[model samples]
Target: MIRITKELSFPLENILFSFALKSEAADVFDGHNTLITGIGKVNAAYELSKAIQHKKPSLIVNLGSAGSNYFQKGDVICCSKFIQRDMDVRGLGFEQYETPLSNLPILLEYGFEMEGLQTGICGTGDNFEMGHNTRIYNVVDMEAYALAMIAMKENIPFLCLKYISDGADDNAADDWMIQVHKAAVAYGNILNLNKNNISI
Candidate 1:
């Protein structure tokens, strides 16, 4: 079975419509299933963790948009790892970036191969730092790391599929606005088609 969280629609325009599909399974072949959580951000992770505990689905897939410093627009990134870039305690008085805890190891152990489509660290922050901050992360997003961390704690498998919608610069927000439709289509179709092909 496959489980997709509500955060899946983050990069799409039809958020309400997509959210309507939450808790319901989008029937895919090979026992693959998809679920969505309408709640977003930190709430996304918190809610999704509860959903996963309730369902105990086989795999967790986080599909969304990512901004890049080095990536050009329209690039698809399959994250191998995630990082919490904004969990800075120094300002609050602490140091060290926190890595998300997840059941990714279970997925790997269960034969889910994530071997080099684009291996890089996905930096996470509460804010959308792409257009205004133009941060230099391989991939930047709001929820993946939190989701991963939750999955890790639960010992469930997790994976993130992201499409680069902006370059994480002054134009990042606008760039995403222009390419959002295309990004949504591509991401949805890819999820639809790769229902059983988990070989990375």
Candidate 2:
């Protein structure tokens, strides 16, 4: 009864490998479980929302890589709330990317069980935010906020779990390639423990 989605093949591939190694229910959705959607914050959101509607899972987990300021590579971030920081609706005027507050607390309550975990606002965008662009936020990624937005609208209990694959700077890409495997393992551990309800 858990549904998971990823924006790219790398993240998806890692996620699947993690699932295989960690969960007994890996074969539950053999064919229909994995949905291959190319990257893009918006596109992944739409496709994932549609998939959620179709699957109607009890829990929806979004697994991927992200850039962070305070976190080191391989750190896991279980977002208590996800937001679309790039959406400028005040001037044009509407909440373009708003996700519901799932009544979940915003602090690390299960740190003893899961190590190196942090809780903070995840700023989502359509592009990989790096360098000076990261000065305004702590962490950046392509899909979390949008996925959270859609999940809120669809009335699903969504959990945004992303592993820090890079720091927020020019060196991000290189860092990601180097740390993704370890990040994936950390993500799998987070999932296996079912820490979604533990909040931030």
Each model's C-alpha lDDT?
Answer: 0.55, 0.53
Candidate 2 wrongly placed segments (more than 4 Å): 1-36, 89-116, 132-136, 193-200
* Candidate 1 deviant stretches above 4 angstroms: 1-33, 38-40, 91-93, 96-116, 131-136, 188-200
List the pairs of residues colliding in candidate 2.
107-200
So what's the TM-score on candidate 2? 0.64
lDDT for residue 37 in candidate 2, whole number 0-100 = 40
TM-score of 1: 0.66
Q: Write down the worst ten-residue block by lDDT for model 1.
A: 11-20
lDDT of 1: 0.55
lDDT tens per residue, model 2, 1-200 = 22232321112222211121112223332332444344567577667756766666544556667788777677777665555666654544444443234433221121111234566567777776666344334677776666666666666555666678898778988987676556444654544423232211
What is the Å distance of residue 110 in model 2 from its true position?
18
For every model shown, what is its TM-score relative to the native structure?
0.66, 0.64
Residue 75's lDDT within candidate 2 is 71
